[model samples]
Target: MRNRAPRSRPLRAVFAALTLVAGTMFGLAVSAPAHALGNGLALTPQMGWNDWNAFGCNVSEALVKQTADIIVSSGMKDAGYQYVNIDDCWMTGSRDGGGNLVPDPAKFPDGISGTAAYVHGKGLKLGIYESAGTATCAGYPGSLNHEQADANSFAAWGVDYLKYDNCNNQGISAQTRYTAMRNALANTGRPIVYSLCNWGQESVWTWGAGVGNSWRTTGDISANYTSMLSIFHSNVSLAQYAGPGGWNDPDMLEVGNGMSFTEDRSELSLWAEMAAPLISGTDLRSATPATLSLYTNKDVVAVDQDSLGKQGTEIASAGGADVLAKPLANGDVAVVLFNENASAQTISTTASAIGISSASSYTLNNLWSHVLTSTTGTISASVPGHGSVMYRVSHGSGSSTGTTHPLIGASSNRCLDVSNGSTTPGTQLEIWDCNGGSNQAYTLTAAGELRTLNGTLCLDANGQGTTAGTKVITWNCNGQSNQKWNVNPDGSISGAQSGLCLDVTGGNVPAGNVNGTLIELWGCNGGANQQWRLG
Candidate 1:
């Protein structure tokens, strides 16, 4: 939400001398029950432009208007990027005498209503911002004690979305505070997309769906490769907490900012696969054709807008290669093969292993290339380092059925071979040449658990380590949180404990083949050490 943009706010007493720094917004009214409010605003992740990441407190009506115009004239509006959000710094230094928030006339001389009208005329919606706390992050007035007046003001202004941030919030229940805004929005008799920006405090994912249309699952996103990938890894595992209407936001897009071309593609592709919001955080008024093209890539957009709201699951991760699978309503599955390693990688997985239908053959359509091919239940690709490839696969007319097999590594060309034939808790996992050993066989259950079918043990993130480079081991099944796992659509398996991904220690060619190099948890760096191919 910032150039170091402040996060959304929390409820608290107003502060003195409110400094100014802008955050973000999308709609005015209407709401969701963590179930995306069933209100029909962001049925798919909301696509729009947010100002915080680009301009911060420098936001002005002129900039917003020009941005909205560019969104339409550049074909972004036609491509479904319709919301023109005004993040922070749009409010006056003080509210009106009626205790209502006021727009700063110096910045918005025609006022919010005029801006809203102008945006709506272009077939776009207007969004406003407020903090749950007494002050927004930059010290601007917040909604802590003025939820109703604020909501009323926004509705009257024809605001279509509301980005509620949490800053300056005195210690209070996030549930209670966020619910206050939720109820307030509902009372307005208008449809607003409620976005909760609590920065993951209180595991917002757990209760956010019942309150807001989308909840930020991470901290702010910077315009760089590491920050973007870091957020992606953090949010992907929380997919289960989101459903129709409610989404888990991984922060805004950084595609047009500063990352490499390949990295930008990976960013866009991964966000689409995850079903997260696609709010642009760039200077759209000066965007290049390449930037606009990346924003409007039809194939990527289609998979993201697919009616099926299910977020993709990470099917496999080892040595920096991951596969995430999103089931589409069209009986097709959208798969993204991502290589997070420094070098290019050739990864593969079977339709059945990734949770697609067990049909004998699958017809593959490259979403990026539009290339069509028929596979007999197997999908493979050579993904560039730090880049990704996406495809839509449907059941083919061929007669082969899907099969289950061991996960094989690319660099080592070894199976997810176990260190020993033991099924006890604490058994070490390693990559060894394929031998069809019973130990090498594992199952990714619908419950998001990777288990030894015959052994009855679940893969566990040792000690529930949340930091990068934790140890992963086997444990007896217990319904505890740490034992749960998520197969992200990026081909990485993230544990429920810390949401850190599975990694191959010293993940290199020959060293990775050694029986026990300590397969551990690590920050998902997209290295080959975290990649695996399901046979």
Candidate 2:
């Protein structure tokens, strides 16, 4: 049974004094490197089980003990579920005389330290919750004014993980608030995995690596197919920022939570493709065999735990059907074909489509089946509506290495300019003669969205096809499929909206008039117009 709030409490003056001291101690600013907080602790995708979706604020010492017991006995521990997290609403109204934060006496009579000891005794790490804002999203006390005190208390309690949320933090820059906690944690000299949960504010991925170990790249995930897919899609553009010690969290796992199986499988596959964390958000004690099987597939888990730590990118989509691909550390590739449509759709993709050379014979491992098969140069699979099929493709026999430049850096020598006066949307984009101009400098975000050095969206031809004459232009940053462009080494740009390569229509080469030339999508012709010099 879920634990509820107590009807009565003892009013204590010591609680007030502890709060005052905590506020006073944290009021002083500390100077340190901003990235110091995430510098310590586990550098891999955190594998854990959180008690929020199943129990919410109704958690108790008994409940935690039962969950911990189940985690140890259920074989999830051997499968890599280590951290047992207690999220939100576990705090008491006050701190103790030792300057240590107290857990709600009714729910945790032994305090947080006792809970940590118990969890550690089970050979699992312990994780606690806090908020950077004045109040948590669930309306509990936050660490806004108690950064140092909270950090000290948490460290003393032997807390191994901290999921710092962003809620009710008004009038404060996220950087400043995060930096404060970071400094506080560093002062304690304890290694804690600081997870910055801000729902991707201020382009968190762009700077999150300099702050926390992981950042929530999207909003909360629900226990349904639509909700899970929506959250997964939202993070597609930010895939590049995920890596060792820094990850783009798509929220906790919904496996074995009584959600639809199709949705659960799709969610698992997509998360694997993105290389996101696999923290289970289900009741381990009552988990069904199917759920356990789904969560324990070592083959699929390998994709999530790939050493390369590179996030996957979407290659193409048609009629709500999309294909996403990620390069693995073993030089193989992982592919996810998703059918977001109302009905089933057959999604097809080639190795070359995802920047890999076509193999004579490829070993295709179906992540869902946990089985492997050999296929020729081409492979196709059918995906159900709101479902996905994930695969690991490797060379079956011979390895053919090809020169592929998936991404290009923008520098003084390699850059090209857009025609002057072509800043508006739908303007034809061309690779002019190389010049170290501001217009030539651009940054490709991990989300695959192209932006000017100052952060303006580089759009595709009305967000559609590879036809000859699709114009490229600049627009405000909106995460539309059309505004996402994948830079290829063949000196061509492909639109995420249509999977069409940016072409110099008809290979036109007049100097100044290259401005109004029609931009179209075409095959990789290796023409001077198709080859762009990235600056």
lDDT of each: 0.76, 0.68
Best by TM-score: 1
Runs in model 1 lying further than 4 Å from the true structure: 3-36, 397-535
After superposing candidate 2, which stretches have Cα over 4 Å from the reference? Answer: 1-42, 96-100, 397-535
| Alpha-carbon deviation at 195 in model 2, angstroms | 0.7
Model 2: per-residue lDDT, tens digit, 403-445? 1112211110123345573566555555444455556556666
| Candidate 1 residue lDDT tens string, 1-535 | 6512333322111110011101113343323234645666677889999899878899898998999999988888878897888998898778788888889999999899999999998899999888898888777898997888889899999999999888878777778889999888899999988889877666677678878889887777889888887888777776676677888899989877877656877899999999998899999877654466568667789888878898888889998799999999978899999998868789888888777767777887766544456888888987767889888888874211122457654334466755777766787677676788777776766565677646488778777777776777888877677777765434455687786767777764444545556677877654445555455
Each prediction's TM-score against the native? Answer: 0.69, 0.66
TM-score attained by model 2? 0.66
- Model 1 RMSD vs true structure: 17.7
Candidate 1 lowest-lDDT run of ten: 15-24
